[model samples]
Target: GGLPYVLTAHEGSAAFAADVMGRLTGAPGLCIATLGPGATNLTTGVGNAYLDRSPLLALTCNLPTAQLGRRIQMAIDHHALFRPLTKATLALREGAVASVLAEALQVALSEPLGPVHLDLPEDVALAPATEAVPAPPSGRRLAAAPEPARRRAAELLGAARRPVAVLGSSAMRLRNPGLLQAVIERHRLPFATTTMAKGMISEEHPLSLGCIERARRQVQRELLGGADLVVGLGYDVVEVEYEAWLGKVPLLSIDVDPVDADASVTIAHEVVGDLDASLGWLAQLPPARPEWGADLAARHRERFQRALRPPRAGFVPHHAIDVVRAALPRDGILAFDVGAHTHQIASQWTAHAPRTFLITNGWSSMGFGLPAAIAAKLACPERPVVAIVGDGCFQMTVGEVAVARRLGLSLPIVVLDDGWLSLIQVKQVRRRFGLYGTDLGEQALVDPPAHYFGVPAIGAGSAAELARALTDALVADHPTVIEARVDPGHYLDTVYD
Candidate 1:
């Protein structure tokens, strides 16, 4: 296979890297692992692909055919271990390598793309065989739903007093966003994006309601509360259920597949087929002059902007994010780790392009930032890539710094240092519980190693210092870790829903 690969620090790291590669490249990303412990570590990222609908192929080594059932070292029921975590669990039989591989790829990249596990027994690891013809990838350019269904969908939009649209994770697969944006503009619809779908359209676009899961989520949710029609364009219910947001509102779905609307969400009409074709159909429908005053999305967008303004002057998360945003170019890739910082960036960061902002809203794993950034850099070397991790997240994946250094990857690892699991701490406090296990002991990166396994480690105490550090890392030969010592006070002040 001509596919690119990296020797990651851990099996989990490799899988996460594959996950990002799949999302960014719109093809199956492949990761190889050894038996037992290696197979076990891959579950987190593999599960992320399962729920997130990313195309991934997880190849693992196992005991030889005769010894597979015995209690040999590093032997376990791998098929059982991965069955629940993958779309399909397959094995390499004597002469079926080619066919098994073809099936695995077909399943991994099918509708609602997900991870597929392929186990290669030791004896068959180096075997050569005739290659089987792989199934052709599914065509996404199908005609929009039947004319009656589309007309009904259009009729619902035409008759509704207030209709809103939501862009979901599936939108990332869009080959032409211009068509999607045309439909949004033609209808003058207000729109909100799921966390993972951030930047399908520019967050700064006048029609954007920003992301709906964090930072003033109440404001965004309330905007969706009064909708008469909710247009779910390529929206996948895994990131958010229709019941939580849309409630009993009538839904019109336009995507490559039928929308997974919850029971409470009435299917007013569904235009299921090619998204661009549906969007083209919507664009051609005589523009409907609805009852919404002005564009509700653009109007609410102002309120969202007001709420996200720099709330305090200290070296806080919001301010730190502002600095990073300013230093990063419009095309730079930001891979965010899961934590309190995720809540802030998901809403506050201004994303102009799809796949430029990578976060795991489906599985939402910690320690995802480093590997994701590394893989993103590998995929698109011309674009600058940075990993924004929390203090806790940095500790969990710190060993990957060695991987970054070894590869001479020009990636920057930015750690927001508050020394605790801030997101979980908020929940504990809400329950009137003490800090307990959330604390990470030390708050400062005192006497931080000058070089982490040959990669430089630097400290930034203020916004100005952080900007300088990021600027330098962009041109560095290897990975640079910048510990931005920031206060966590702003997290409690701003993040919500």
Candidate 2:
């Protein structure tokens, strides 16, 4: 196998590493660990993959069969521990390795993809087996939309005075942008995406309404309520809760699997088949009312423009986002860590293509930015990759930078230093409880001592300096860490009313 193996400092962070690898490569990612603490450490990443719907295979080394269930050191029920977090959990048997691995891989790559766990006891690993390796699993065959279902979906869309498309994470799997674009253009439909599907369609497109998580509630209400039919293109309940559209609109789900909406959300029609095929069918139907969502699109554009403008002073996250957006090439990929900065960046960052802006909104896990950047760089070595992370998140997995340096990766990591868990601090202020245990003191990650991890470090306290630093980092031959001092109160101005 030509697969490269890179070790991380912590097992918990391995989740982000595998998540980014799966997300970028569209293959089942592998994460390895030993029993006890290593196995427990993998739980965070495993659970994150489970919720985020990334295909991951968690391999752990367990105790021997004889030692199982005994009060031995580093012994625990690995199967029971991972059962809830994985699609399937198995203890590897000496003679069944081939079939077990094949089955586990299949489950991991299936629709609504998730993590699978395999516990390999030391004795089982050393046991002699005569069984031959099984053949690789066959390629997955996508289900096509049935004629009757297609007709019903077409009829519903045709009858509606106003139709809108709500794209979700599952749409990313379609990989048929042209067909989806045709459907949207043919119907003159205004489209919105979940946070995870930020770049499903280019936000720069005229009909795009950006991300739902970034939109104001009133805007979401008006757009969704005004629609006579809401066409869900590969929507997943895990990405965006059904409560958002419940009783607000009539949904027509079009996905590989049937709609997973709960009782509150009523799906009028469902086309349970391939996304591209369904969209191709819809594209062949008569276009909806030409001016159905024109007004809403205009308002969305207005808000999008307003959101991109630089603040009067200070290092505003949106301003930083705009600077980075301009600095990187159109196809460059950006990974964001979970924090107050994510919401603003999700709204303001204009992704020109799919898979450009990566974030962990599904798991909302911190310290994902750096690992995601590493995967992005590996996936597209020719394209630029940057990680925009918060101070708290950077501290969580900052040591990974050493790995990046050793691998000779020229990754630009921008650390937003606010001296606090800014997202939680904002929530605390809103609740009038005051910030406690959130502060990390007034620490700035400026100039590193010479040869610090063999990486250059830069510090910026203003928008201009930050932009300049990013420009330099982008062209640098080695890894660069940019510590940007930003206002902690900026979240209040951008996120809240």
Candidate 3:
């Protein structure tokens, strides 16, 4: 009764559930599937979660050892296939269930938290084993900054006149929302977050600059390049181009793993420690005077304020996001998939609390939103959960809609129908690269829109239509989907360009 779950109609949804759950919940998220195709169908989601460095555990059933190579149709190389997608992949021995489960969890939760896979033979789940359950091992250390490293990081942040902390997916995973806020408030640091770290600190907080698309904001980019001390708190390399753009700024890197710490550029100091513990140590240190950073913070705040203005009319994408925010519950949960819509939602939505939003930060996978929405609703059924996805993404896992209906999951899904692979199109436009397979022009937008089982559904063409659709969907008692048809040109101009 305490948690809500979405058993999507397909394996892709299962993978998405694992990712979304991993993103929102600090603990490792788990997903299970039957043998054969159920396991293969989850490939994309698993890869996405793995690449994004979400803490996830995926369990898939396999053909019994007795039938391993007897030409059975269900028999295939699941273990080998999943090897590349997970940091560790183990085939569960019939009598070693306890050990396998323990190992899988340990690896998934270890430093640089990422997905782990355990393939169980079908017979193991049904067979009786006489072996003793092994105790989970100790001394499997997670990464954290040592005392000296912590002191160094603190000294850097404490002394720098113009210092700023850039938060990332790892910070969200470390579960130190209050730490960021404390440091920001204490030093009056105006911080920016990558799309994945949207809800780490409530956007309404005074120090929050906004969800930063690194390519577009010139002033924020300049500030990042020029800051004397760039405190990367749990920042991941995949989310930001720090090496290329951060200029000569010295980075005081703090994260859960050595790999993430190693990816830092212009490092004056590195602290690989549990994020919370490191932050706690830093919290004990005196705040550095905000001499050089105060004016810079004010200027960035002004730019941030101007950028917060949502487009008022026409078929603008930002306006659609505003409509959803206005219509939904302020405490509502937003589960976003990776695509053009992901950044737009993060930039536009105001995350007011922790666990209120989810994103595929590490991998930026496309078909994650619907499954995440289901998982969020399952975890917190009473709160409204909104999923923002792309039309291509919707079609990738649209069948999950039926799963939501059958399972009685009440989620409102918003599909951005830009008809083309908007992100790729933008990349193509900017680089003058010949586009190969990224176009989705022939794809259908469901002019009338499709329903989620019995839930109401509509296809919106204008800003007013989206507002009306969202109003009812947000208030509806059951599942609903609003497919907003958008112009392909309306997106984060920087990244796409």
Listed in order, each prediction's TM-score against the native is: 0.94, 0.93, 0.89
Instruction: Please report how far candidate 3 places residue 341 from its true position, in Å.
Output: 2.2
Candidate 2 lDDT over residue span 1-497, tens digit each: 76688888788777678977887887888999999999999888888888888888999998887888898899989999999999999879888888899988888887668899999999999988777877756335477888999989888888887777888887776657677778888988898888888777788788888777552434565557777778888877776676655466888888877777667777899998877788888888887774463477768767665854535566667767777888888899999899888877877777888889888767788878888888788778889999999989988888888878877887899888878888888778878996798998865544434534777778777778888988888887778988877776667655643
- Which ranking of candidates, highest lDDT first? 1, 2, 3
196-306: candidate 1 lDDT, tens digit per residue = 888888888877888886877788778787888889988887787777767677888887777665466788887887766677788888776667776666678778867
For model 3, give the 10-residue run with minimal summed lDDT: 488-497
**Please, what is the whole-model Cα lDDT of each candidate in the order they appear?**
0.84, 0.80, 0.73
Stronger candidate by lDDT (1 vs 3): 1
Q: C-alpha displacement of 221 in model 3, angstroms?
A: 0.7
Task: State which candidate has the highest TM-score.
Answer: 1
Report the C-alpha lDDT of model 3 over 247-362, residue by residue, as the tens digit: 67787777765534335466787788678878777766787776654355556666754564434445766767778788777689888777766656766677877678777766
Error at 361, model 3, angstroms: 2.2
